[model samples]
Structure formats: C-alpha cells, structure tokens
Target: MTPLSPDDYTAIRLSLQVATSATIIALPLGFAAAYLLAFSEIRGKAIIEGIINLPLVLPPVVVGYLLLLLFGRNGWIGKLLNHFGISVIFSLKGAVIASAIVGFPLLVRSIRIGMESIDKQYIHASRTLGASWWDTLFSITIPLCYRATLAGMTLMFARSLGEFGATIILAGNIPGVTQTIPLAIYQYTSTPGGDQMALSLCIVSIGLSFIVLLLSEAANRKMARN
Candidate 1:
C-alpha cells in the first residue's frame, strides 16, 4: 500500500471538520424540527414533514443540483451573500451546507422518535403545575430525549462523513480546501495507480465512523446510569 500523502491527511482532517461543523449546525434545527413534528398541532404538518424529509428520498446529485441553483450567483441567496462577501458555492461553507441538508432527516427522525416516546403525562403534569411551554420543554422534554438527540447527532455526523455527490457538486473537490475523505477517495480512484491511497482513506473513514458510534453509545450508557 502506498503511504498516505499530505493531501490525504488534509482530506481526513477536513472530513472530520466538515462532519463536526455540519452536525453542530444542524443540531438545534434538527431538535426544533423534531419537536415540531412530535408535539405541535399545526395544520399542514404532513406537508412540512414531507419537505423536511425530502432529501432522504431524493438522489444526492439532485439535491446538490437544487442547492447549486439556490446558491448560484444568479440565485437570490447567493446574491444576498455576495453583498456580504460570503460565499457558499464551491467553498467549505458549501460543503457544510450540503452535508447538513443531506444528514438532517436522519437527525430529525431519531430525535422525533425519542420525543414521541416520552410520556405525555409528564408534559401535562408540567403544564398543570404552571410551567411555561419553554420551561416544560427545557425541564422535561429535552431531558427525556437526550439519548435520542445524541443518537441523531451520531447518525448525522456519520452521514456527513460519507457525503459525496452533494458535496462534490457544492464544494468542489479542492484539495486542502473543501475536499473531504469521500472526495479524496473519489479523486484517488479516478487517478491511475491511486488504489492504495483510496484504500488508505477508506480505512480512515471506517475508523472514524466506528469511533463516533462507540463514543455515542458510551454517552448514552452514562446518561442511562445517571
């Protein structure tokens, strides 16, 4: 096997960075979406949920293309960001956005399952005791779903790590810039005599994913014990 190059190392680092960033950026939004789906009584919920979970069913390439259109120079968002000197297309920010959008449904699904499992009696009791909605949410709802939230984050992080098509389209596989593990592997596989490098990155990707799962399970167990 060929020794990993500096660019490979950078790809590894960037993969982790992008995964972490996407997970962090998506966490709050995921939680809110879950909370809405689980507890809210708004009309058109089915429509809202369908939109939220659309990426899960759509081809990643399609998602990427849609994102590209939304963030292209002629796109409204792109124009607005350009005025502020912020770029999303073909950049690290674009990579994170792509990952977040792709992985968000998993996060929301996990958290929603957790939230739905919580005993409604407790929530009712909190409300009966004069707790505000926010107070009940913070004091009861979120605590009960902590494990689910962690699981969601774990799933999202792993998904982010493996994201390829959407990321390639939005972030462009620029070495040491937006290139991640999957992107680097894609590059290596296309280049002659680069099988060894691709294999090396695959091993790294597997190891990182394993570590994330282990840590998530450990945290869940610790929370259970507490």
Candidate 2:
C-alpha cells in the first residue's frame, strides 16, 4: 500500500489526464451554460437547464450507452469522425468525453450559483461605462466570479477523477489507455488476492479527493481576502 506498482501509477496518470482533459473541455461551455441559466430570458430556459443537468440524475451507465449511440463508429457523429480517421469509442478521448458529461452539471451549477449571487450593481455600472457584453464578461463578470469558476472546476475535476460507470462502459478498462484509477481499483477488487492492491488505490483516491477539496477551500479563502 505504501508503494504503488507501475500499473497503479499508470492508472493514476490516466486518471489525471482524463480529469484534466474533461475540465478543460467543459470550462468554456460550462460557463456559457451557467450564464444562460442565470441571466437568460428564453422561453425554453427550464428545458435547456433540465437537459444540461440530466446526467446528474440519470444513471451513469445509461449516459454511457447514450454516448455510445451518438459516438460509436457506426453512430452518426462517430461515423463522421471515423471518416476523418479519428476514433473515440473505447479510447482515452472517450474517457474524457464520459468524464466531461458526468461532471458537467456540477460545473454549471456552481458557476450559476455564484453568478446569481453577485450584485447586479457592478454590471449596471459596467454597462453605464459603455462596456459591451463581451467586455463586461471579461472585465466585470469573470473577474468577480473567478472564485466560483475555480471552485466549480475543482469540484468537476474531482468528479471526473472518480468517474467509473460511464467511463468503463464507453472507454473500457484497457490498461495504458483508458484504465483510470477507478477502473483499476475495480479490476483489482475483482481479482483473487488483490484486496491489498485495491485498498491501496482506495486510500490514494481518498487522499487525492481530500487534497482537491482543501485546495478549493484555500482558493476560496484567498479570493475572499483579496
């Protein structure tokens, strides 16, 4: 448990890659989604929000199956991608996609809460100063909501790191490719005499999650004081 094996290290590395990739992919879209849900006056706002948040309530396995339907080689988007010699199914890219989908709701919700809590006075002032929507977004909205965005990203990162059901279904547990920490732990637990290995991975997972939470809190405190 103290020392990790090469395969375990690989799993950790893959997890980091998947989580980071997922966060990066979701960042801009998540912010846009949060902004829309918080400020938009569209008639279908609730419907859009529910669709965005479906992954949170739906089973992860179900989400994965849906993704497969959309991105499998024979599937619509997957066929287009395959025509270009790109592959997603059962690949690292698939793992990132799965993690991103599973963690998207958390990212959107956190930013939405932060944006909604912000005083509208600053926005009005920015508008009065002749700042355009894009300008205000960069100069006012984003700056004031930086802490929230960071917190959301951190939470989403943690979620992505722990993603299992969707990832296993879409990405598979192929070592050196899509075998993330959770998949590795599952594999170890299922094997005979592999309890010790599974336990070690579990501890590592707990430690990493705790560290991410602490870092998120520290960032919030720092931003609050600044």
Candidate 3:
C-alpha cells in the first residue's frame, strides 16, 4: 500500500467531513422537495422536477459555475452573507455547498421514488381520518418509506465523497481547508512523481464507493424481503 502523507490524510478526513455535512444539511430539504414532487397537486410539477433534476443532467462544471454565481462575493446572496462576515467562496463551507448542490438531484430522486412507491390508499385513509398532509407525511409517508430515505441519504453521501468540479470551483482546493479526496487526486495527477499517490487515492475512492453501493444493495434486499 502506498503510504499517505499528512496532507493526504487531511484530504481523506476533510472529504468525509464535507460529504457527511453536505448530505445531512440537505436531508430535510430533499425530503420536502421529494414529497412535494411525489404527492403534491401543484401546478408546474414537471417544471419543478426538471429543475430539481437539472444537476443530474447538467455538466458538473456548469453546476459549479452556477454555484459560484450564487455564492461569489458580489452575488446577491453572497453580498448579504458577507455583510454578516460569512463567506462561502474559497472556504470549507463552500465545499459543502458545492457538494450539496451537485448531489441534490440524486437525493431528491431517491426519496421521490420512495415516496411514490408508497400506496395511495394510506394517504387517502389518513386524509379521511382527518389527518392533515403534514400528519400523513410524518406518520405514514416517512415511516413506510424509510428505506427510500435511507437509500437517498447513502447515495448523496457517496456522490458528495467523489465531488470534484464544483468543490474546486467554489472552494479553490486549499490544502487542509477545502482540499477533498478528489481535489487531492487532481493535484497528484498534475505533479511530477505523483502517480503512485494518485493511484492510492483512486483506490481509496473506489473502495469507499463500492462499500456504499454494497450497503445500498443490502438495504434494498432487506426492504424487499420485509
């Protein structure tokens, strides 16, 4: 095994931290959006879904650029946040934001599928029994669709782990700050005598992804069996 440098270790740790943070932060939003897409009787549902799933179809670089526009110092939201002494551009928080944006579609899609899979009768019965949509969602939708939520979380986590384009664009790959596994790998590939290190990180990345995939499969099988 190729021995990792201190910076490599930091990259690995930061990747895990950033990925976990991004996925956790996006969970509630993903659930709400997925629920709306799956169950709501809203106009322009198709447009909402298209926008939600844009990241899946758009190039990563384009997504990164869009995030930069939204979070850059002169950007409206960025200007407001900056006035309060908070800045996302070129920071670890930017990395998290980038990851969340990039992985959001996957999160929403997974949960939406889970929500849609639930029988309509349950929702109807809850409504008939005087349960509000909120009550039905919390009691019936979330409980019965737990597996889909779990899958969505895992998928988002995995996607964030390998995030590169958006992270580097928004966070600038500062070592020990915003440098994640993918960024570190990019650096290795560009430097002289760094092939071995790059390969090591690649192996680590692949191992992590494969483990998540295996867990997802196991979860699906368990859900099916139940």
Give me the candidate number with maximum lDDT. Answer: 1
Query: lDDT tens string, model 1, 1-226?
Result: 5788999999988999999999999999999999999999999999999999999999999999999988989887998998999989989999999999999999999999999999999999999999999999999999999999999999999999999999999889999999999999999899998999899898988999999999999999999999
Clashes of 1: 0
Off by over 4 Å in 2: none
lDDT of 2 by residue, 103-183 (tens): 999999999998998898899899999999899999999998898899899989999999999998889999888999999
Question: For each candidate, what TM-score against the reference?
Answer: 0.98, 0.97, 0.94
Screening candidate 1 with a backbone cut-off below 3 angstroms (N, C-alpha, C), the clashing residue pairs are none
Task: Give the per-residue Cα lDDT of candidate 1 at 11.
Answer: 92
Candidate 2 local distance difference test against the native: 0.94
* Model 3 lDDT tens row, 61-143: 88988989998988888999998999999999999999999999999999999899999999999999999988988999898
Model 1 spans with C-alpha error above 4 angstroms:
none
Ranking by lDDT: 1, 2, 3
* lDDT, candidate 2, at 119: 90
Q: Please identify which of the two predictions, 1 or 3, would achieve the higher lDDT against the true structure.
A: 1
> What is each predicted model's overall lDDT from 0 to 1?
0.95, 0.94, 0.92
